[model samples]
Target chain A: MISLLQQEIESQPEVIARLLERETHHIQQIVAQLPPFDYALIAARGSSDHAATYAKYAWTTLAGYPVALAAPSLLTMYQARIRMAGALVIGISQSGQSPDIIAVLEEGKRQGRPTLAITNDGSSPLAAVADHVIELHAGPEKSVAATKTYTAQLAVMALFAAALSNDPRHMEETQQLPTALEATLRLSTPIMQAVERYRYMDRCITIGRGYNYATSFELALKLKELTYLMATAYSSADFRHGPIATIENGLPVFLVMPLGATFADMLTLAQDLRER
Target chain B: MISLLQQEIESQPEVIARLLERETHHIQQIVAQLPPFDYALIAARGSSDHAATYAKYAWTTLAGYPVALAAPSLLTMYQARIRMAGALVIGISQSGQSPDIIAVLEEGKRQGRPTLAITNDGSSPLAAVADHVIELHAGPEKSVAATKTYTAQLAVMALFAAALSNDPRHMEETQQLPTALEATLRLSTPIMQAVERYRYMDRCITIGRGYNYATSFELALKLKELTYLMATAYSSADFRHGPIATIENGLPVFLVMPLGATFADMLTLAQDLRER
Candidate 1:
């Protein structure tokens, strides 16, 4: 029996492929229409926030724009008058119903700053409030745990990053991501076996760095939401700073280190944790 | 015999008072000397990172400068070119050590952006690279878990917030903060009694929002570093988004709700958690 969650999970490659194929020109047009901005202020919650986290690395690295994750409570609750000058305000949401995320875009619009929303629902209030809307087009996400929308949001961020960079290599790599995701999904059988070993695991920590920092948080959120596990995510460097003390004899620590510039540091931490 | 951690914790009021009295003018001068900047990018690790979290809210709300906590790995591990134009790069570290943080300030200086260091050690490498330095005059901090330096860093953030605003009332309130700390410390006896109840607690989540969001992380870090408890911190808004499902019977949860605009929303979350 294919669970809706599993179906959504397996559909990621297709969803991302469709997203890139359908939205590449649209995202490029959106980027072209935008005014010159010095930085990006992104407002999101839950899995969308993790997408923003990925964008924090992606936008800064690829597009040369510093990205900051906005604390929506500052606008909605504290009524803070945050300086939005020279900022491209962005809101990322699936349903786009969250008032806090919407309030940030509204504030950005009120301040006359350019606002953009990346959401699954183009008709959502979040999209309505933004100067530009990048629809996920991942179709209806009914699993309630946000499996498809999360990846779709990441796809949108990758699209925006490529658009902003205007580099042929970046665009080619963006186009190839769905194939990479598809190949990655083929290893689920071994991953399922590995999960069997941790059937009784109640709590754990997820560690990643650089772009995968978003992967760490997203993984933790999925574990918490779907498995009802108390999973906390930390950057590998931050985990070393103090929480390394929390590691004992039999505790589980998940490290999300992809092969990249951050691999060596994460490998060192993994070796250290393994020795413990 | 009092534990070293307890003694250092008790010294927070005096440490903060000494910091405010000495560094207020210095911070003002640093702010005045700075070339006008559009935003602030801060880098830190461990408890110092929590202090940076406080400044993210403080600088945005009081000073009207959007604050972004920088991912140091971008500069260090990835060797990524980040646009630092119009950014006042600041690094906060008690020891002013962490090469990752200094790397950020160094890159900021390389990009011709103004840089600042908030550290207890004026002679450290971080201070050497910064255009200006604000010393946390909390004297010698011997505790392993960072008790005095955390509050002192918060004091420095408050002072900077006050200095940037140039509002006399903000300065007056900043001056009186140490007195408030002293008053709050009087509740230690009850807090001690409450601690006894959680003696067997192995894991918990700390929640806060707005300015006190930093307090939640600081408290969680202290718990992890000192008590070896698996404590995670989340903003109340973020908590409701998903991790709230982890709240089962007998699970310990800490909420840091300071009296402010965020109080009511926190109270609602508190009530929801209490019912659970």
Candidate 2:
């Protein structure tokens, strides 16, 4: 029998396709309500936080609005000022029950800022406090790895962003993401065989840039959670600054390179990581 | 003889005082010339990136301006359009030689945004592109751990931020920082004994919040660099989101908690980590 994690990982493409096909109009209505803002504050945790990081780049690259990853302590601990007079605050979560994620939207509401909740559960506490909710609609994610849920979160943001920007090319790409994901599933046998070579692997670096930078963080977090491997994520360009020192002669570093404007830099970094 | 790391770690309060005493007028002039911005983009790598993280909270809390930690590849790798008009872009570095950091300032300049460089070397390439430079003046730091330079960078940003906001209490606190660092040195004996207790430990988590969130990342990086341990840093709020699962009974999770607005959250996170 196939592992639950593997099956969930393979479910991403279909899950994402369903998200866009069924929920595009729902997303469009929510996007229509949000007033344009100069900045965004995204609150999330774990895999959802990784998705927020991706949204930072995607929102910045496609829409010109800069995004900040919210440290919930600012709200919960210090009662630090939210300064959300005209900002868009987003909270993302898989379980939609994280108190920190819930509090961000609550604080956003108190500050009178436009608040949004992108979560898996429609009735989760996070959705309750949010001014708007876009449920992941990916169904229940039981495996601890968070495979389908993560990709679904990414799809939600991608579709939201594409609709907000009215970018047809991005919309088309979002529609085709499932087929690409199915192809990725077929690589499982080879990937499992490849993994067999590193049964005792201890520590490594994961690198990515632009859209895939979120992928690097997600992969690193999963590696640590599932396999107890020490995987640190870094931007490909940032890796050259000082982290290259950490790489010894045979230090295994993984690159989360996907075809994008950031691909060339990843290529250079990968080559340098191998050569050095 | 004291190790360079400890000596530098203990020099922060003094370095910060000197930075404020001598450069406050000059920094004030820079601040006077630059208009207030809604957001800030800080670009750096490694320990400097940690300093940037501190500045994110500091600037927001004190100056009420949100800051974004630039991924650098956003400029060099993807060449994303830096919608930086009227934005304050600050590039930080110790060596003043990181091509990625330099590229961020270059892009900032091209976008007609005000640029600032905080670096140890005033004559470095990063300075050449920046509209203004605040030299750390911590002198040569040959050690790889980045003890003095990191603290000095933190001090410089703090001073710059305090001056911009014209907050006297923060300025006074800045002046007293070095004395606190000296007092912290007295903890070395216990710290060393504790290190001896964890000789075989390979993985751990470092937690912090608000002003000292950056300290978590810096300490984690140093632990990985000097001790070859896998240490990951998380904000107290963010840590509770998902990473708290990794904590088992007796797991070694180091915290860089100092007395501040975030101290209470650190205490709560400590209890959670210990309980689970």
Candidate 3:
């Protein structure tokens, strides 16, 4: 019998495909109804917050809307009346049950700003307070770790970003994500073999920047959740800040450097780390 | 001979006092001259970024302006023209030398938005590009890890928040920081005695939330830089999200629960960690 976690992990391509197929037109319709928001304020936690971090780059780069992740404590604990004038508030959660996240969208609605919720459960309390909801359609993430919902949330963000940009090309590009994810899943044998080498590793650092900065964090979270490793994440540039001093012999460092704008810098840092 | 790091550490009360005495009126004047910004977009790295994190809570709570930390790579690497229509772009750097951070402010200026620089060097390129500058005034910082300048950056943010709030009470509270810091320094003996036990500890996690969430990261960075320990920071609420799974019987966790709105939550998390 396959473990629930492994089943969900392997089903991501299908999960994302179903989400894109179902949510693309729905997201555009929702985006069309929203007031002209100058920027976005997102509230989330765990893997969902990591999704927000990805949106911080993707939305700002692709949709021309600056994105800020909300300090949910400000709403729930401090009772801060945050000025939301031209902002759209969004809440992302797998269970959609966190009170702090709900408080943010509630506060946004109280201030007469548009509020959106992206979650696996459309009928969840988080969706209750939201003016619009994007259901993940990933179906019951049974494992403690959120795999399918995380990818589904990212797909929803991509769909919204595409809709916000009013560019058909963006949507067309997103249509290719399922195939890309399917091809990437084919490397699981090599990935599992690579994981075998790091079995004894108790600690590691994951690094990336720009869009994939969120990937560094998500990868670290998965390691901590599944393997109980003392894993941490940092942007490649931020690693140069101070934590780089902690690097020593036998320390495992994972660099998520896909061939993109940040590749050269990450490659150089990899060399620097090798020298150290 | 006293190490420069210790010298700087011991001088924080005086450094903070000097900053308050010299920069209070200056920050007010700069604030007065600035155009009304709906939100703040801050660019920083390392310890300075932690200060910006402090502002993300402080400014939003006190000044009622939502603050977002910039993804400097978006401007520098992706060449994304971020929407900054009503944003007050502020760059915080001890040296004011990082090009990625400088690129954020430069892009803000290119977009005809107001830009500010908070740095120890008034004539640095960062200051040259900004419409306004707040110098840290900590004299020469000789330590590799920033000590006085970090606190100085926080002071500047407090001053700005107070000014933006147009609240004399906030200014009055800011004036008490030096005395409070002085009192905190008196606990150095006990702190050192406590730290003695952790001498052999190689890794740890620090937790806090709201304003002190910044403190957690800053403390973790100090531990990593000075002791070469694998230290990581998380908000107490965020800890429950997933990272709590990584905690084992002997893992050391530092809880920065200053008495305030977040104290109760942090205390509960500390108890939870104890059980784990």
Candidate 3 lDDT, B1-276, residue by residue in tens? 989999999999999999999999998898889987888999898899899999999998898899988887888888877888778999998888889888888988999999999999988999899998889889899988899999999999999989998888998999999999999999999999988988899999999899999999999999988889999999988788778988888899999988999989988887887777
**Residue-wise lDDT of candidate 1 within B1-276, one digit each (tens)?**
998878988988888888887888888888888898989988888788888889989988887889887887777876777788779999998888988888888889999999999999999999999999989888888878888888888888888888898788998898898889899999999988988989899999999888998899888888999879899899887788788887799989898887888889889998998899
lDDT of 2 by residue, A64-123 (tens): 656778766556665556566446889998888888778878878997888999988989
Q: Residue-wise lDDT of candidate 3 within A1-276, one digit each (tens)?
A: 989998998999999989888888899899889988888999888889999999988898887789888888888788888888878999998888989899888888999999999989989999999999999999998998888899899988988888888789999999998899989889989998988989899999999999899999999999998888999999988898778989999999999998989999999999999999
Name the runs in model 1 displaced over 4 angstroms: none
True-vs-predicted CA distance for residue A227, candidate 1, Å: 1.6
Against the unseen true structure, what C-alpha lDDT does each candidate score? 0.88, 0.78, 0.90
lDDT of 2 by residue, B24-64 (tens): 77887888898756678888887888898888777767776
Q: What is candidate 1's local distance difference test score?
A: 0.88
Global local distance difference test of model 2: 0.78
Worst 10 residues of 3 chain B by lDDT: B267-276
Worst 10 residues of 1 chain A by lDDT: A72-81
Candidate 3, pairs of clashing residues:
none
Instruction: Give the higher-lDDT candidate: 1 or 2.
Output: 1
